[model samples]
Target: MPDAAPPPAATPLAPVPRLDAAALVAALRAHTGEEFELVGPLPGGQVGAALVRRPGRREEVLTHWGGASDATWARVARTGALLERARDAGIPAPRYALVARLPERIAVVQERLPGEPPTRVDLALVQEMVAIAGRGAGLLRERRDVPAAELHLLRSGPGFCLHESLAQYDERTRRLLDLVRRIGTGHASRMAGDDLVHLDFHPGNVLVDRTGTVTGVIDWDSVGRGDHRFALVTLRFDLAVPGTGAADRSARAAATRWLDNRIDDLFGASPDGAATLRAYWAHMGLRQVDWAIRHHGPDDVDRWLTVAAARLA
Candidate 1:
């Protein structure tokens, strides 16, 4: 017999604890009746969790504790339902399946979309996203008669508030919160459509393939009915330079232009719209800062405070 080629090098997978790993394998096998082999840890995101995949399954499965809440679990359910509805409506979305929802853990089996991370945001993709978002908003706005509890924003509200300020918080955070309080209770101007806005639309949240085509947008945790301009503003908030980079200033300018154009084109929102968005940003960002200070250490508290202050400014 011809000699088989040497086995491909094994990837240095991040170690999952022996007990937890065994439990996860058992749970998946029980649910899918197929043994799951460990793949690797998922990319770091705000939500603390790990993921594993099967040898040849089309769906990747995640193991998480925070998402198992009564409210969050429902949101995930609604997300899957919305994606399905969108697909039938000729909207692009990944296939999703809910595998297990245990008392302490939640897992969702989802089809991996075809795309790699994009190198930069292409303007065409931006327009496409806005169009899809517009359609989604229209759908949500039409259904506003639905119970408020069924709304995505209400569920996400408890999750989006700013964290408490820790002792080590920097000066910048103070400025940010002060600005937020100043924003007061202003209402966002009603746009033409009110469907669904992927409130957390950002470059990193979008996926694209090598050809630079957007495959599908992920991270539905923030999907809900709200001002379309809120979505626009969140996408624009990254204008602040991170550390020091050559194009930091240019990036901010481009982001500002993008925000202005999107707001004008999609919503016909005016200068007052900008203030409303900023106020919301300060308020929500401070909520996050508060949560961080309460949960994290000195470094995180300081960083959040500084960013919060900068946002207010």
Candidate 2:
């Protein structure tokens, strides 16, 4: 039997959205000529966004709240343009079109790429995307020579990366902060140069087809100049701790093993790569804890923070 091609890289997570579906549809319909049908919801929560199927069309329409900032809509437009540029650059990206932009929301009607939701947290799939992430990192490193700083998630400072700037989070936030400090300060690993990092890479964001063939790597919102190793570590963290308890240990280990080897293949299993990966692991974990605290309620916040604290301890 022929070995199947690996799944595509994960999509970058979007800012949580409180979508106004009706309003978004209205705006989208007004702007586009095609009819869009109501498909089932995407896997993530309502705040995450939904998938709308266009009848007789191979594409999907993704809608999300642009948050409160007046520039949020503009950012969506810019993101679409960037995706187009990336595709032209020979990157594996979905065909994208911006259909509408309202004061409160934005709608992107884009090609629905092949592949199913990631099954069993495969490391090969993770590395497939990490390689792309590294490519993105290389791009950012090249772009650093340009006079202008590209608008990207990497532009956020240490405070944002560490989650120290948000005002509303409480105890959970503090716990995450403490962990961030330990992870960021630990001298185990360090690297210089600002390469692009896709801070979010998980099974939920990745896709794999039935034959294990990776079709297209979607999502580019978080692409920016930063540490590429950090991006790889962020994806690897989820595999390191796949689930809440012992039942998933074997799976986690398998995934980890695959990633460990792949990391070595791409970056080489050298002291420098190891150190760089360690730094990224710490940063990525801290970021997850911060996100859980800020975006989730008491139950989730408490759970993630506890896990984070234990790791730091």
Candidate 3:
């Protein structure tokens, strides 16, 4: 029922729990007494998400929270309010309608927003997403209670941005891990500042219409406080990777180059600009590489390796 519990990801990634959609639906019914109909899993999900609807309510996305820690839940608690502020600031992030802490596992019901994941991150979308990042430039400055973003550059993150995958994947990843550790030693451990940080900011998280205008940004599960510029690094890594349906290789490369130039232009002046980017890229390198190792095929891993090798080195 839960997609056959994808064969346990290889060691290191083994800790990463595949989202159990059927179990979540059962948990929702048992705990909330809401008979919601499953509308199948959402596509292009780095992590799993599903669509659900009930008779009287509009469709909402259901996110499984099987492997998140208490700290993660704590962040989720404040996320709703933070998203509200983000909305007020003109960033179209989805709001958490309900966080159901069932015995089976935590399940999050989020407000379903508009648009679909764009097939490609063309120049227009890149510019738009970068502009949207500016809207929440100092969003969390006053929210002293929220946790700053964890880079996990040096160490393994809770379940996602792992280090072992790189250290053990291959010679290429092993070298990348060395650089990550070096950057980690330079003190980029915790992302500092008040700007809103969506750790997983990428094309998959944002939705757009045919004309490529971003309709909404979803998947705020990893939302936290940090220099929003960090998101640029994440987007850069996500865009550079081979997948993403960009039919024209040259165009994809051009878009990524454009974003890289923008990142340099924007972050080059900050005090810790280079250091911070090295750390962000390191974390993203480990995250994407490890994900490819665990969830994708060998060809995918090789493609990721080529992209990561080019950047993290």
Query: Which residues of candidate 2, in runs, are more than 4 Å off?
Result: 1-18, 31-34, 53-56, 65-74, 88-91, 141-175, 179-196, 240-249, 258-279, 294-313
What TM-score, over all chains together, does every model reach?
0.69, 0.67, 0.89
| Model 3 lDDT tens row, 127-224 | 88989987878888789988888888778887776788767666666777788788788885798889988778888889998788999998887788
Model 2: per-residue Cα lDDT over 182-262, one tens digit each: 555554333455554444655655567886556666555555445556555556656644465564566667777777676
Off by over 4 Å in 3: 1-12, 67-73, 243-247
lDDT order, best first, reads 3, 2, 1
Give the Cα lDDT of each candidate. 0.53, 0.53, 0.78
- Using lDDT as the measure, name the better of candidate 1 and candidate 2: 2
Say which prediction, candidate 2 or candidate 3, comes out ahead on TM-score: 3
Question: lDDT winner among the candidates?
Answer: 3
Candidate 1, residues 104-208, lDDT tens digits: the string is 666666665667555555455555555665556456655663222212111123444432241124445444554554554343322224556565666566677
The local lDDT score (0 to 100) that residue 102 gets in candidate 1 is 57
